[model samples]
Target: MLARNLPASQTTEKVVENCPIVMGFDLKYARAGFTVMQSVLETTPDAQFCAFNVLHDGLPDFAQRLGHLLFDGPRSSITFIDVRPHFDHLELFETRHLSRAMYYRLLIPILFRNAQAVIYLDSDMVCRRNIFAMVDALPPGACLGAVRDNISRGDRARGAMMRDVMDHGPEDMLELSLADYKRDVVGLDNPDRYFNSGMVFFRPSEITDSDVQACFDLCHAPRYCPDQDILNTIFGDRTHLLPERWNYVLTFPETVGLIPDDWMRHHREEEEHAAILHWPGPRKPWRDPSVPQAEVFLEMGRRLDERLQEVAPEFFKDVLPAS
Candidate 1:
């Protein structure tokens, strides 16, 4: 159990004693998920024991095996929650990068009601630093915290689409013209601050039922990144943009030269001191280890494979097919 009385009104430099981290994944990424958990345990060895709330589709055998492996160590406690029931409402939406959008709005709040704050990390990422530091540094009154998106830099079309839906209504989003999304949706007055939803530090207590419903309603609208877009639309103003080091997005070597020098410098710094490595685009490390810096992810996967072979050979069947 976690402390639930943390104040949600203003910035308070205080850190919670016990922070709970949550992650959502499907069977397709179970191995990656295990690697992520293992990395966190390995990196934050000194932090007091933490709890990991893993939300996944119900698979008895896989869940049992994962439980045994994760619980074998005393550094963390694991709780598995089956999210199959939430699939019904998501059937109409196209699940491009996300397995289920409801996991962000509905599932997290419910599962972490007792927690004052929960760090929600995508299973595809690996932890490189003590995540509790971010949890401790969370700004008060903010519903969500995340790193600024590096890929969304010049793409102003997304902002335009969001503006269309907000101004004319959800039905008009697709019909809107794409002049400049960043200037339109993100607002010219405010700094162009779009965040990547891959790694989020959420204050579940601050999110209300109405906010969840608003997120669900936004999901019905036509958007490129549904859950991410909805979250930005709803909490964009209240979001606390953390330093990029916390959620460093990886880039490929071939395309690296195409980006601006400043961007390259930022990425290099992030790579050097990355607390979490996020494989954002379609080219993931598992699919193509030839990508620069992919060795890190591949190493984690290799370690997970070895552990699976040793403790639970049956679960090894879930490993990705040889490329």
Candidate 2:
């Protein structure tokens, strides 16, 4: 951990009845947030959804209209936090699938000092769980609760190299192995302990400026999965590792046979029971038709377009399901 100053920008708050849930995204992915949030709302309507402008990307034009039509658009709803000043200076780390927005949730503790507990969800997630109840189930004094990622729980051999663009092609892809990098940088002693940053609940109690500084220090350089690595390094032993169902990674061809065949039957059942389905890495279901649950996610976008077309036809001029 190191010492650093938190940004002085004030957060915009809109009061909600239940749990305060935070999501980070820019204008490009704002539509994805709408589809994902609407899907979650279908299951759990009381959950408060906040759009975090991590890069100070101005509010999406459709937000005000959607405020009145759908979601908690009425008064005392949908808190919007402007975190532009905080991240504007940094050279953001991103891959083909990830964006600078991936780094936004790291500063949640510093930005949201008032909330009792904050839930951070990536825009790419689609879920059917009562997330608020999940927050309630966290053990006392639990700072955070998250699922073990595909790497942490599924396989350790896959950790040998990161499947990411690192200014290196296939010729030198294994130059810096992920497991070796983690062991050296964060002193990662236990291979099974690394947790993903995508879906997490933070019950912040005494998070100090120093802890926030540690987040800043970690991102000073880019790794394979920049934010995921930083969060694992900083949270260390504090993360309450939930079951694999909390954030199950949708299987693609490359990931299908990796899990042993004996457990494939169990894995299929696990998929049906997954609380939140995550489309991690470069290939996203919304964009790539080959993904396992691509239709399930695209259907969400189609449904979102249909409703908006009925009420706000202008919003769907470009069409929601269109790539």
TM-scores of all candidate predictions against the true structure: 0.79, 0.79
Candidate 2 lDDT by residue in tens digits, 126-201: 7655455566557886668887665444444454454433543343434656666567655567745777888888
lDDT of 2 at 203: 71
What RMSD does model 2 have? 8.8
Give the per-residue lDDT digits (tens) of candidate 1, residues 3-73: 11211222232434646877776556666777787777666644356687777766456554665675456
Off by over 4 Å in 1: 1-16, 86-92, 95-98, 101-106, 157-179, 182-191, 252-265, 314-323
Give the local distance difference test score of model 1: 0.65
Cα TM-score of candidate 1: 0.79
Cα error of candidate 2 at position 256, Å: 5.6
| Backbone clashes, candidate 1 | 3
